[model samples]
Target: MTLPGLDLPALQPWFTAAVPGSGELRAELVHGGRSNLTYRLTDGTDTWVLRRPPLGALNPSAHDMGREYRVVAALAGTDVPVAPAVARCDDPAVLGVPFTVVGWVDGRVVRTADELDTLSAAEVQRCAFGLVEVLGRLHAVDPAAIGLADYGRAQGYLGRQIRRWNDQWARIATRDLPDIDTLHARLARTCPPEAGASIVHGDFRIDNTILDPADPGIVRALVDWEMATLGDPLADLGLHLAYADPAFDPVLGGKAAATSPRMPGREALARHYATATGRDPDALVEGLAFYVGLGYFKAAVIAEGIHARHVRGESVGRGYELVGGAVAPLAAAGIAALDGSG
Candidate 1:
């Protein structure tokens, strides 16, 4: 079968040459990804995962294979659980776009409430705490020590993020959202000073991780590093909390495991992160609200981008139609978070 974004006949020789000992290849698109096009590839005996930018119009600085590969490659020996990076092809001549290949990891991805329900309540709580623990470990890793000191700018990260997402909004907005503009202005006005800088996973949540099937508390691998960068660690925490908002449900097709009522609330997760990272409780509680607001703004913009792609028939997934509905609610949530009502 011909895949939407892959040409198997053309890729066979390249994969064989790049990954020695690999035989003939077969590829299939992996669902649940709204941005990058992820493929599961195999040669009958060995398997690998390949990631590339989605087809059609591209967003500036988004869906970067090199960035994902570099960060995952550097994190191989760290405490962070990551799939083994195998090879990266930067020559667009090979696949019409840069792509990265990583060794396939065997684990379960609890993306929906139904999938999460298979685990016991205790397991669910453990899974939640496990995610928080892993995030703390990620924030503790020094960027410079991992040869990623230049991964992204740490200075003025909040301000730059505000500007960058605003630009992204302007480019992908299907409809004008005045609340988005208000949220942006509020974020700029209340942007907090960076407490410190570290390697922040642009997206950190249950669905983004591969959890051990037998033990949900064990995270096997942390995937999707396209947005990984050197930035305020709190931003990562904020985004994690933002994902827990019910407003995010539409983006994940209305049953996001992260938004499940069975899962721990945002306050619980935030407290766990603070305790795990040893941050001052009072300071984290205060600074975190702004980051949470920023997180919602970022998510809303991302949802709008996905909606735009769906409109242009560029998205390769089942739930793009529902993503557009998330933008307005998320923007309103951001405003509430900043106003101390969320």
Candidate 2:
């Protein structure tokens, strides 16, 4: 019998041909990130990471494996530590969908409070500051220098983000969420001008990156490029702060993967980013409400979508059952962020 989404018997030939001396392919799905399906593939001596859209229906732009490959490929020699891209397989006839493979990076993803506690206080501080520094470095990169000038429309990014998420809310909303509408209207009214364009990671935080297993403070590679695009850099910062909200823990079943108590405070993170980038912290703080509102709105919409899939019995996973309960809380958080209270 063939594996669920992969046909190893057929793929072994293609993989071996593309990557010489491969043998006895084996794959196990990597469970992290919300948008794309990822798997770790191994052939005894070597390992590779494969990424593709989740099985069944998917939002095309949200899971663009080719775009992920292209951006990561373009970042080959950049200061950003990314898993090196190996090859792209765009023919669905072979694997039922396009998939990208990258050299497997050896590292650990620290998420829980206990995990952070294990590291000395100094190490914990280092990991926390390291994350913000890396994010600042990413925002400082010039897209054209990396050949990603046309990655996405940089102008009017905030408006586009609002519209895009609002559309998603309409498609999968299971019930009425008045606060969602309230937050949307508020965010639209206060939408700030674009904060200059850069390569936005879409979802940036600690767990999204892999740390050196030995050193913990050093970042080996930044994974999960499903939502990567050229957009306002502040959007990434906002989302980073939003994810830090305790409300997000519900989506991950309480012990959220990136909530190590040792991590720097949200205010500290913003301050660090501002200092590193020479941006005015006061301006960033002033717009925090809008960005944070956008952040919570996006989270609520994504949770609703996952709940929609679960309702259809199309998605089965540990956190799927709990996602529906998260929307209301996130909506409240969004309003609070806008109110300068969250």
Hey, what RMSD does candidate 2 come out at? Answer: 1.6
Please report how far candidate 2 places residue 112 from its true position, in Å: 2.8
Residue-wise C-alpha lDDT for candidate 1, range 1-342, written one tens digit per residue: 469888788788788889999998888999987888899999899999999999998999998899999999999999999999999988888789999999999999999988888889999999999999999999999888989989999988989999999999999898989999999999999887887899999988899999998999999999999999999999999999889988888787768899888898888888888899998766687678899999999999999999999999898879888889889999999999998898
Q: In model 2, what lDDT does residue 329 have? A: 89
Summed backbone clashes in each candidate are 0, 1
Q: Which stretches of candidate 2 lie over 4 Å from their true place?
A: 1-3
Clashing pairs in 1: none
Candidate 1, residue 342: lDDT = 84
Task: Give all candidates' CA lDDT scores.
Answer: 0.91, 0.82
Model 2 lDDT on a 0 to 1 scale:
0.82
